[model samples]
Target: MFVQPMWLVMLSWAVLFVGLASTAVVVVDQFVLGYRQPVKVMEMVWPVNALYLGPAAVLGYRKWGRPQSPRWLDRHGSPPRRSLNARTTIKACHCATHCTLGVLIATPVTYGFGLEMFGSTLWPEVVGDYVGAAAVGVAFRYYTEARTGGRRAWAVMRKFFMRDLLTVSVFEFALLGWLALMHFVFFHETLRPNGPVFWLIIQAGLIIGFFAAWPPTLLLTRRGVETELLSTPQ
Candidate 1:
């Protein structure tokens, strides 16, 4: 009798390789193709959909879909203020500044190094792409929040579905599916395989994805402060 390799074992190994390869590609692509504007940062939408929203939806539905307050509220006795200003801004400024600086430095380093090592320049283009995407993100967030009249980010997303499972599921699925297909199918012809175009696609997808998702990230991360303002004890 012939013995077959275990599917789980093969999948685990494949996943490990994919993770490592993807990381290396990102590092190289960000500096090389991104710097060159080979692909718009909006391209990042595909990967983020595939890697983040896709998985998050599955896990969130399975784990946190029921009616329940957040753990922080449960532990800290709800929020205290609607807006965070002054001290909070000062404290956050340092971290945000550092993060921005890191991106600036990383972009150039990756671009220069990848060019020297692999004969491609991507950093500058990616920076431009991300800038555009970030602008879009900001606009989307502001418009949605303005419409909701101060609802939290998660609340806004929930409201978009009007609390209907079919609505939320369909929308999320479509968004993710569109991104995935764009990256894998529609953009396949544009990918240069071994060339710099391949690298640019990686950066673009991430940039676009992050841009589209930034509003959610901001709201989710700052929900504590917002809740505090609304729920403060009289």
Candidate 2:
């Protein structure tokens, strides 16, 4: 029997705690605060961001997560709210969140299964990351669209698939590119799928991918391929 390294174990626990804590914040905000009006995608995105960014993500949410109602009364007898473009940032954040989470899940699973199934090939990890990210991204899009009702299942799925493919691909490309550089150039060590260093690297990649995916998201929104998924406050 072999004993695990203390550092590795500590890092693993840290990752687990951060991921869980971030998820908890988003869930509570969505269900308890009744901020579930817009699309549920944001709820998912926030927690995922929190997973990587930790307290910073939570702070951002407190500052900019929900639309701000105006202090002055409007002609409609309610305060005016922020424009949809403001929330578009949140939407773009969702793209990054889903892709990052997918990759995080896929890397270790594929690494383990691939070692067992294929006996030490890198392809399994690569393929798994793409497949997982694409699957999650498409699923989230479909769920958001489906909740709107009045659309056929096949139609909703197809629309989401087409819309998400390019964006998700871009996100993965940026993320993997950075990770590859880290492993091959800077670290000069074999990549450890479950290591804490791997996760910290992934967090940096996620931030990079978020910026990379933003333009495409904005374009999609402008082209009408993507719309506001969040519900308006009643």
Candidate 3:
């Protein structure tokens, strides 16, 4: 008996397809066509963000991301100057990508397996989201640490590990609140991940999460609490 309005369903699907298509274009550009990012972590970050940001992701990639690539630098001599907003945004995205991966993976798995805790899927969904984000976030740290190449590399990773945990907590807290509002108040639980409304919900969630997490990221960066994302590249 629960169903989205026909028009909402159609619009959601249209947005979903566009997001997927944008992701495809990013993948093709990064892997198939070799617009590879100079920094390793961003290779994953750009495409992951595209899943929700749609064509806006592509435009962000073109303006900020692509110019830092080896291909672009080789062609243009040096990357262009960018504002602090660009730097702050890209750094926040490093945390966001892992967070996004965790949520997207958890949502369907919890639903598909009928995974429940207490009375609903929310508990396991949050658990899975944090677990997945931690896993990937550690890997991102390792990649940067590996480039540092010293006995102190592990120490560097430990600092990054702690920083990421903090960053992800803020990111997830905001996103979880937004999603709870959507799930409990706005959309209800009528749609599965296979449907457009489901993806639409999460897409909206991540976009809002970006803004939610940005201020803390800016404060951390400006205060020198975190440095690797903007400073390191490979």
Displacement of the residue 88 alpha carbon in candidate 3, Å: 0.4
**Tens-place lDDT digits, model 3, residues 1-234:** 576899988999898899899999988998888888867778888899998888988998888888877877788877778777877788788888988999877877898899988887777887898888777777777776666663365675577666766778888888789877877677665556777887788888888878887888888777767534552253
Q: How far is candidate 1 from the true structure (C-alpha RMSD, Å)?
A: 18.1
- What's the alpha carbon RMSD for model 2? 5.1
Show where candidate 3 strays beyond 4 Å. Answer: 150-157, 230-234
User: Where is the poorest 10-residue window by lDDT in model 3?
Assistant: 225-234
Q: Which consecutive 10 residues in model 1 have the weakest lDDT in total?
A: 225-234
Pairwise TM-score winner, candidates 1 and 3: 3
For all predicted structures, in order, the TM-scores are 0.27, 0.73, 0.90
Tens digits of per-residue lDDT, candidate 1, 1-234, equal 222236633653454445345434433443353311111221232222323223432232222211122433455553344234322322122222222233335445545455322333333333433343333333333343563385466655443333222222222233334434544466542333243333333433433433443344344335532211111123
The per-model lDDT (C-alpha) reads: 0.34, 0.65, 0.79
Q: Between 1 and 3, whose lDDT is larger?
A: 3
Q: What is the lDDT of residue 104 in candidate 2?
A: 73
The top-ranked prediction according to TM-score is 3
- Order by lDDT, highest first: 3, 2, 1
Compared to the true structure, candidate 2 yields what TM-score? 0.73
Backbone clash pairs for candidate 3 read none
Clashing pairs for model 2 are 37-231, 38-230, 38-231, 39-229, 39-230
